[model samples]
Target: MSEQSNPIRSAIAEAIADNPTILFMKGTPEQPACGFSARTVAALQALGAPFAAVDILPDPRIRQELSEISNWPTIPQLFVKGELVGGCDIITEMYESGELAEVLGVEEATKASDPNVAPEGQPVQAAPLGIENRLR
Candidate 1:
């Protein structure tokens, strides 16, 4: 089936469109399944950037559809404003350079001093089949 006609691809696209900031990763932000995903989550959390997370491990198809749509064959994919921002390495670089804060619209003063300190509160999680919830 064509990507446009694929339901999973359609849902993935919709999720990207719906959430200003979203991460399609191996596991939930609170419990990342891989180091790459964990680092990505930490970067966003340190910046106190509110984002929607979709755990792609529950279904292999989720990762497949997401990678197909993103054209980024990486587990931790970060999308901002419905555009692919990149994966862990890129995110880490951006975070270090303060570019991630700019991308996420995090104020200079709000950027956490310690990258290890995750912001308080639960990150929004997108449902596997029907992703719902915007960055709050």
Candidate 2:
């Protein structure tokens, strides 16, 4: 981003950079404040893919800044490798068709989404619950 951007924009950029797969939604992944957010979380969780979520409820400014950063006027936005992918609808479709796993580079897309899959995917490999909750 250019230096002309605001400080908050810079912070959002930094946050997204720190996380590999990011979801800028209306609430936390575990306890989503909105139906869309909850569904979005479920989609990713079902894929058993590692990802980081960001709740846009704390500061309305964050929501505004995110929109400006991505030029997307939606709350439940998805990003892969710092690139804006799509929103909840897209994720849900991907989850159903097993596209998310491919995008995340998981070997067994169906098995990964299956809860029966051993060694369930975690937020962080070396850090336990380090990036667990999105609300925090």
Candidate 3:
């Protein structure tokens, strides 16, 4: 079917295009329904990054459509500035290295929400590398 006829695809497109940071996850960040999602949420929360999250579990088509669009067959798919930034493990590593904060343009904290702020730094310019997290 054409994307015009598929509301799910259209919605996914609009959401990705509209939001600077969005996560197509299995559940809300506040209550992630899966372990990977929970970890992903925690990483974003640690960075204090505000993101729009879409729960793909509510509709099977949402996951399918998102996968088709992103060409990444996984939930908890993170998009930063309209670009895919990989899934749980990548996010965790980036969070640890403070790359996520740079990507989100937030002040990189030595620790999450620590009072002692570090000097302003530039974001690491890196291409999105896909790390498949097919484990359920």
Model 2: per-residue Cα lDDT over 1-136, one tens digit each:
5745566677678767777788888766656787767777766666666777777777777798889989989869988888887887787777667777788776543444432222334442221122223324
Ranking by lDDT: 1, 3, 2
Candidates sorted by TM-score, best first: 1, 3, 2
What's model 3's TM-score? 0.79
lDDT of each: 0.80, 0.68, 0.70
In candidate 3, which residue pairs get closer than 3 Å at backbone N, Cα or C atoms, i.e. clash? none
The list of candidate 1 runs beyond 4 A from truth reads: 2-5, 117-119, 122-136
| Model 2 steric clash pairs | none
lDDT of residue 51 for candidate 3: 74
Q: After superposition, how far is residue 18 of candidate 2 from its true place, in Å?
A: 2.4
Top lDDT model: 1
Candidate 3: misplaced stretches above 4 Å? 113-136
